[model samples]
Target: ESTGRPLVILDLALTRDVDETVRALPGVVHLDLPGVRDAVPDAEVRQVDAARAIIDAEADDFERTLAGRSMDSLITALRSHIGRVVMEEIERLRPLQSRLPASAVPSVDGRADARVVAGGGVIRANGSSGAIAVSVAAPETTSEAAAKVSSEAADEPVITLAQAERALHHLAARLLHQPTVMARRAGQEGREDAYRQALELVLGPDSVGGTHD
Candidate 1:
């Protein structure tokens, strides 16, 4: 429910364009101006209260929808929404090509960047700083081979075995966020099944169903 009263200061700003269009209509009240506040009577205060209640209820619904959802899920949802909005804006601005200079258009390269996968127990240099480290363990044999190879690799900064282990932990945390680690935590069959169910609910079926024990 909406009370026709602005529930937030930002709402007032958003209504400015709509208010201009309303003012253009023949018999519409010109409540767009700041002076219009002076005309609000004591009875109109009820409208503000109604609007506040509506806004609060909407906020509650938003909180509930986001509850227990991972940060990644929230980020993905927001990015998807923003991508749609950006596409719409680009389409809207397409007709104004003449007004917008050719130079004003932003340039973009459509190439897909290569993704480097980190396997566990494989030592490699940090891409950003060229610091040596290991990926999370891939397989037992592969991990052992990687550790041995890393140990023999010359001219690399010497990170001790203990330091390398710590780096693996950090790398794991970086690549797999808390929700994934929590879902994989060791437990008996019943508890593990419960965790799997909870994970399916949170991360969706694709994340939980495809993995084999």
Candidate 2:
């Protein structure tokens, strides 16, 4: 079985070069050194080691060349050195899609239908057609949660069932943190009718603010 770790490769010469380049570019971090070395095989490690050795030798020769050079020469050399360092540390990771575990991925069917805004109540998936049935009650503490419960209770209510359903959908969009499938059933125009029917079934005719049974 695969360990699920991504394979990474580091090239010291490339890392140094990237490091220097990044200093000039700004806002970029070179990861060719530790990052890649920690993830790749021994062959790549040997190549990185060789590149570092070459860079050190080149630095010595360049220093000698600057012995009699002017300030401009020194600055140019400094810039090049920084750029080389930045690039040398750049590493890459190769990801294997087939190696990924299925359990690690999310399921598409686990989505909701609509959410109640007041209490974060969400209509159950596939329940929006016949009656507005919720998969779960709205959250008790959330403003939307509270609103949903209160709206259902208040006589001469300011919030209508249709409006509540819309609010639920909006709340779901905001906080349910899941995609909602709109319920489609015969004779149902929107979420309100569905919810009303669900409430009537659950709460009965004597229940306050429920649809007539």
Give the candidate number with the greatest TM-score. 1
Q: Write the per-residue lDDT of candidate 1 for residues 14-36, one digit (tens) a residue.
A: 34745455555544455443546
* Estimated TM-score for each candidate: 0.27, 0.17
- The global Cα lDDT (0 to 1) of model 1 is 0.44
lDDT tens digits, residue span 82-104, model 2: 34433432211012111223322
TM-score of 1: 0.27
Task: Highest lDDT: give the candidate number.
Answer: 1
CA lDDT, candidate 1, residue 157: 31
**Model 1 lowest lDDT segment of ten:** 111-120
User: Once model 2 is optimally superposed onto the true structure by TM-score, how far is the C-alpha of residue 116 displaced, in angstroms?
Assistant: 99
